[model samples]
Each structure stands twice: as C-alpha cells, then as structure tokens.
Target: MESLRAPPTAAGGLFPPLPCALEALPLLGVDFSSAPSRQKPVVLAWGRRAGAVVKLEAIERFNALPTLAERLSAPGPWLGGFDLPFGLPRSLLQAWGWPLDWAEAMSRYARTSRPELQAAFAAFCAARPVGQKFAHRVCDGPAGASPSMKWVNPPVAWMMHAGVPLLRTAGVTLVGHAAGDPARLALEAYPGLLARAVLGRRSYKSDEKAKQTPERLIARKDLVDALEQGRQPWGLRLRLSHAQREDLVEDARGDTLDAVLCLLQAAWGAGQPRGGWPGDADALEGWILGAGTVPAP
Candidate 1:
C-alpha cells in the first residue's frame, strides 16, 4: 500500500492518487433518487484521493435515468460509492422463496413492479412481530441504514430496485455481491453513517424549504470542517475548492455533500483488501462500504 499523501504536479498543484492498484481510477459518489426529476435529480460527486486528502473535482446532476446509465456504461477504472442498497436481506429472500443468488435476485427484483414490491413487503411486515417487522442486513445495524426492503420514508428499497440494475447492466462489479468489470467497481455507501459520527443526530439538511433551518446549515458547516481536517475513522481528508465548499454548504438538501461523503468512503475502500468488504459479508444482503467491523446478524 502507498502512503496517503498526494504528489505534487508540475504546475505546483496537487494530483490526488488512490492507493495501490486503483491509483489511476477516478472516485465517484452518487446520491441517487429512485424517481429522479429536474427538482430532485440524481447527484454525482466526482473526485480523487491521494494519501489523506480527497479532492472534490466536480458535481453533476442527472435528471433522467438514461443519462446515469450512459455515464456508468461509458466509464472504466472508476470506483463509486452509491447511496443505495445493492441487495436485500437474506432472511427476506428465503422467507419469500426469492432467488438467493445475487444476480438472479437482482434480475427478479428488476422485473417486479413497484406496487407488487410494496404489497409484498407490506405483507412480510404484517406477518412478523410488530417491533421486528423488517428483516435487516447485518450492516444495517452498524451503518444505521434503513432496511433495503423498506418502501416508504427513505424508499431505499425503491432505490435498490432502480439503481442496482443499472450497475448490473453497466457491468460494474458490485463488490462482494456480484462479479462484473473489475475496473468499474461499485460499493454500497450510506452517508448517514458518516454524517451521524460528526453531527450526532443533528438534522443537517431538508429538501423542504420550510424545514431547512439555520441549525442545519451550521451542522453542514461542522460536518464539512470535520471532513476537511480528516476527523473520521477513514483517516481521509476532503479538499474542496472555495466555490465547491459554498455549493455544498448552501445546498439545503445536502445531495452534493452526501455524494462527496460517499466518495470518501469509496476511496477508503479502494485501498483496502476486497474493497474493505468483510469476510462474513452476506452475498445476498451485501454490505455498506465503510461499516467496519460490524457484528454478524
């Protein structure tokens, strides 16, 4: 493994380099929306990591799924941290007699309709005990992420349905879940996992304008400061240009910032063995990129 420090460029600028074999690959963080539109488009943060510093290079928005698909398919040697579930719980799959194979499961999931998925999940919950309705992946507890089968609230289940197939179609390797193009690796990421470490349950963003308060703005600033100084467990600092910093802090929805957070997680995983996936990670359930040392469920 190489040191985390970035090398200097001829122009006196720093060129970020990822560790080891992935040194040349660009890093991407995607804040995905199942139902993307002009108002709430899918956000992508592009960057690179060298040593401890991860530089923010650009932020992009895709108003349509096709644009996202084109971007994923056109890429090579890029690792992405996507804010979406890559797989469902093993328990849920077995209970429903759904295919246990990752690829087959994803195929079936993609073929199913949204209403069918919702009804099925609803029934699954109805049959279970009130407090223990949803079957959870092992990483969910440690990452504090919603269930992959959950349909409402965060609608992460829908996100998985919408986004995972694109990765599959793009032939990107879903690390620890399915094999595809090794040069294009995709890891599940949860920005909340990192955000909570700094904010401690602070509400840092809200899509609704009425709920975007001053306190949340301060929380975003604090989170940004923490990342810039390499305060997280990943030991990777975030380097944003002045305008980039303002854009992230000013965006009340936090989509751009969340993508960058995911980017850092991906960069950290790129340096680890098996992209930081634990040996015990469930192939059918997948795992979050940086939810380290989580106990088995």
Candidate 2:
C-alpha cells in the first residue's frame, strides 16, 4: 500500500499549495444556471495564470447541469470560481429552524422541492417589515449580490437549489465549508461585484435581445479593455486573442464575459492565503471569494 494517508502540506504547512504558485494549473470561472437549457446554458471560462497575466484558453458551454457536473467530477488540481451561493443566510436558516451544520443543512435543502422552498421563503418575507423582507448573508452587502433566497428576478434560491448540490456531489472542496479533494477548490464568486467596480453602474449585458442596446455593447468593450490593461482591485491583466476578445464582446448575453470575470476573481483568490476567504466565514452561510470585510450583522 502507498500509505493510505493524504499527501503532506506545502513547505509553509499549507494543506494545498496557494493558487498563485500553481500557475500551471487550470483556473475556471463558471457562470452557472439553476436551470440550464439550450438557450441559456452554463458557461465556463477556462484559463491559466502566469503572475499577473491570465491567459484565456477556452470557453465551454454546457446545455445541461449533468454535463457541468461531469466536468467538475473529473480529476483536478483545478480551482473554480462559481457564480452561485454555497450556503443560505444564517438568519433565514435559524428562523426556519433548519440545520446549521453545512452538510446537514445542504442535505435537507437538497431534499426540499422548489415549490416548497419558494413558499417557505415567501412566507418568511411576508412576515418581515417592508424594505427588510429578505435576510442577507454577511457577504451580500460587500459583494452586491442578490439574496440567495430570492426566488424571482435572478432566482438565486433556485440557483442554490440546482447548483450547490452538484458541487457537493462533485467532491470539490468548497472554501470555508465542506472539505473534499484538496486539489479541487471551489469558491463563491460574484462577477457583478467586480464589474461594478470597473464599469460604475454601466450595463454590460442583457438577456433580452431587444434590450441589448449599443450602449451596453460599448460598456462591454470598455470593460474588456480595462481588464486587458489590468484594472484596480485585482490588478491581474487578461490575455486574450483578438478573436477571443471579439467573441466575449459580441456575445450580447454577456455570459462569456461574466465567466471570465469570475476566472479573474478566482485567480485573485488563489494568490491569497486560504483562497482569500476569511477565517470566520459562516458555518452555513458562506462568503463570496473576494468580497472585502464582512459587515456587522
């Protein structure tokens, strides 16, 4: 037997090597869908980072969650920044009297049907005062992400219901939560958080073809240009072929660009200690990968 125990940590006692050092490994930025389809599939941007330059190598589209799940299950020393919530709001979980442990909470959540979840969340909101309907995870304030429990608009609650279970099944180690394959690390990402920093309320994408105006197109171009030059916050420049740049900008839906933004965020996290997640990330309410300072609850 080749010693059934796991491999030893890095020289600094890090369980897994920091991402910045693993420049040769693939970094994935996933723009996930709670309900993937032929029209709006799950989009993944794959690349490798060399110092501050992240080279875009490929763009993958999966028409179904199973396909995405299959990709995640494959062997990896790969790190992913998935645009999905890894956990629910701690306040919501406690109020509903749900399990607080990550595993148990997710297990119970997996079993709950979508309608039941919607009804539960609706009831929770109905009881709260106006302007304070939904409970928020600590990171939501800083990340500018929607409440994970929101059932409409972005339907992130459904995204959590549809996506998080697949990640759990894939056995990737969700940062600050369940530990799995040390080589495969997953972090919650909000591309809009990064985009807003660069674009400043400018709209870069729209799902409705009719709403995809020329201004949005220009915003996309400007955003891409900023990334290539290495904008603030992360300071990592994006290296894309002219064709890749055109492809990202031309895809009016913005899925490709969102995925790439996530990849950059993941790369930034990889360079940090413990994937940039804080030590006190909630037990059942995970934090976004690069969202700075948790606000006071």
**For candidate 1, lDDT tens digit of each residue in 1-297?**
642223332212111223235556699999999989998999999888787789889999999998899988984778889999988998999999998787798899999999999999999999998799999998899888899999988999999998999888888777666667766778899999888877787899999999999999999999999999988776689998999999999999999889988998888877865566665566667878878542222
At residue 58, give the lDDT of candidate 1.
91
Distance (Å) between predicted and true CA of 87, model 1?
0.6
Q: In model 2, where do residues sit more than 4 Å from their true spots?
A: 1-20, 293-297
TM-score of each: 0.91, 0.92
lDDT agreement of model 2 with the native = 0.84
Candidate lDDT values, in order: 0.83, 0.84
Clashes of 1: 2
Candidate 1 least-lDDT 10 residues: 8-17
* Model 1 lDDT, full chain set: 0.83
Put down candidate 2 lDDT per residue, 9-114, tens digits, no spaces.
3211123454334577789999999888988989999999888999999999999999889999998878889998988998999999998787899899999998
Clashing pairs in 2: none
